[model samples]
Target: MRQWLKGLALFVAITCLVWVGVLWYWQATSRDMSPEDIALYLGLLPLVVFGLALLARWALRSAVASAVAKEAAAAQAPASGSPALPSAGQQERHAPFKLLASGLSCAAGHSAREVADALKEGAPRPAPDKALRDDEGLPVLCARIEPLDTAALQEAWDGVCAVAQADLQGAEAQPVAVDEAVQRALAALQAPLQQCLSQLAAWSERFAKPDADGPQAASAAVPAGLRVFTAWPTHWSPAERAVAQAWVKHCLKQDSADWLAPSQLRLMPSTQGGGVALWLEADRALRAAQREGLPEVVLLLSCQSDLSDARLGHLQREAALFTHTMPKAGVAAESAVALALADETWPELPDAAAAPVLLHRAAVIQRDKPIDAAGRVSAQVAEQVVQQAAAAAELPLAEVSALVSDADQHSPRGAELFSVLVSQLAQLDAAEDTLVAGTLWGRTGPTAPLMLVALAAHRAEMNQQPCLALSVDDSVARMALVLRPPAAAGAEPTKTAS
Candidate 1:
């Protein structure tokens, strides 16, 4: 229509110019022209002028109409609290929550291709990835309201979609108004919108800096392991991001107890199920911070100490032969052994009366330096043993240091006791049926410094070595040693076997 109007205007202007020129030329050159000529020229001049005037008027009217149309468009635009255009594209960006505030009046879903077609207030059918099922597998269609006035919302939404595409295409240079689009999309997703809003808000809060400011600014949720201040890096490299994401996902799948320091994560062979498996991830945020310009990389394994007596014992034994066995497999075995000890039931032992002889044997060792009596090791010794354990396993030195340090804090005495006990424990290699004993007696009572000596001999079971018996009592206190020999030929062994 505009093009036609422009062409008509051009034709009119050209015709007027030609008529004026011809009339002027006749006036100048045809001086002796008759009355008819004069009348004709005069008559034609006014008509040409009239045609020019009409064209000018037409142009003016066209401009006025364009101005009025623009004003009307401005007036029709939706404002605050206005019913949003129903298309998925009309909904706001960050402000979908605001549209959702009033609650969606209507939602719809068609096939996969038509998914965003005409959603209204109710939940739509399951998407391609999902299956909405009754007994049989079929597309389940649902809506929150009945007899939907679909035209207004869908048509409004179609306009919204066009606008949204334009906005997204130039997001960097020109952003679209987010309010209408957000409302439309969320209204389409009415059922989960509120829940999604809460989650999104929480995630934003988690990632956003308190001081940062911007439009379209985003703060994606940090992984769960990173929730703690010390656990996550403030500035992460791309590699670190990948590793952290993988580890966090794995941790989330397991029981909470499996979660631990990132350094402690290891590829150790499992004793329970089968081959090797990854342990918990250790923290590397500190390391990353220290190496500012370096690419962030996770230390694959970190050695850690087990404070439990049983765990420490297993670790010590494993360390002795780690090189011979699969280092990874051995470390895994030791770790599993430690975990088992932690999970073991602390069932009450028999009373001293029920097994006096066994109790006597136990008491001999128990009456040592109060620390040693509990089968605990010393901090100094544990540190050394942990170092040895880490070296044997070929772990990073820093990791070993951490393990030893942790051991010192958790069980300061276990290591020293282990050191003392291991040697004496070896001496009773010959005895089985008969018991053995070791003493560390002080004058007034059990002393800070104690010694363990073993004595045991076995005649049966093909000459099994002697069992260890130790005592650490005060010199002033009377020390008595007794051994219950094996019952002759299966007489129901009186004392519980050690």
Candidate 2:
């Protein structure tokens, strides 16, 4: 009301000034006219000036409104020949998944704690690759993991082979031959997968033990069924994927068979952003499991490694996509991340040592244009996804304490993310709160998205605040979700020991 009154007063003052100027001009031009004629002209001037001012204001408002409507329609429109996404109502129907545990392996470190510590210190700088060079004869920069131990990888492979042999013996099939390429891929994935399973096993054991607090405390039994979802890069062949699946089954049977049984093993392969897709699949599976009254734990795992000369050479050859310029070109990197997710109704959830972080349903939207299309980069799609995800989680944008993304140093990706942060999540300090996994780990291929999720979960748990994870690596789509820390209990939330 105050603002409206102020605008009215200003309008009136401008109208009065215009009327006085017109009356003076009339008087100067009509020196022969009577005083009565001058008085009538002055009396009519105020009404005419007021009418013109109102008309101009209406025209200006109409123009502004029309422009806004056109911009909104363009933003919501899909690209030519692109399929329509699900309605917001349909997306909101998805239930939140409980994050029981997480595992990570990257150039910074092998364990989640180690990786988080390294990230906290500062942004990582990529070193020049000794084997790969760009068009300018300069070495390409990359963030490569340290070399793995040959003896241990071989030992693990032998066990997998032994398991494969036993299964084929009954069918009189030939022994599976080991390929060098398969070995290298398997080695890249081994560390994080093993670490994830070990942690899950330990958690299961703890949950099964009777509570020491009192008899009234619930003594929860471990779930009998397990569902594993694994994602590999598109560059890997079918044979390699089959072997990787077999290896995972063997590991579970050998280590977890006493308390858990594998019921389903799904393989998801994609050129990029496979980790985000894997999580979405897991959420769907959980909903189906609930409908069928099945109690099961789901494991989401993914890994990617581009440390080889062949791989780096391929990237270097793509001049349009990659260059030697820092913060403009992508750096070759490798990483692995695993997440153990379960329904909120799991029997042992309440008795767990730490409160589980909740993964709200993700919102994925198609871009109106391709990332490489000739034109200005647009942040509309990215902004829409983030807003939708936050809305689905019922979280206000101001409450999101940090932003984590798989966007590399590429200008388009960086610009898109920066726009979202500045416009939507202005509450966060970009330098102190934003974590770019790609800059730290380089382009980790399929593993980058999951790595972002893992890092967000860790940060949320530590700070007891919500963190947003964004997947902007895909060229055609953008995805975002909220990782919210559990609500505060009477005492403060426990922090992870350093």
Segments in model 1 whose C-alpha atoms lie over 4 Å from true places: 1-206, 209-287, 290-498
Q: Write the per-residue lDDT of candidate 1 for residues 1-498, one digit (tens) a residue.
A: 997798678666766676677678877887676788766765665566657767898999999999999988777775434644444221111010000001112212111111112211213421221222212343222112222232433444444444444533544443223332122222322222222223223323322333336543465222222211112112222332233233223322232223333432332211121111111111223233223432121221111112223332343454421122322211111000000000001121233222111101111112224342335333332234333322322232332111100001112232443453343223222222112111000010111111111111111111221122222211111121112222221243322221
- Steric overlap count per candidate: 54, 0
Candidate 1 TM-score to native: 0.15
Listed in order, each prediction's TM-score against the native is 0.15, 0.70
* Residue range 1-498, candidate 2, lDDT tens digits: 997897688667866786677668767887565677556655656556667877998899999999999998887775544546665444435456777767777777776567667777754556787876665777767676666544556777766765656644534455566555346556666666666777667556433434568674575443335678888776665545556666766655665654443443333332233666676778788878876766667887777666665665555666432454534556667777778887766644455677778787888888988675669999999999999998777678998899988776565888899999989999999878987766677766667777777888888888888899998876677889988776632133312111
- Superposed on all Cα atoms, the candidates' RMSDs to the truth, in angstroms, are 41.8, 11.9
The CA-based lDDT of model 1 is what?
Answer: 0.26
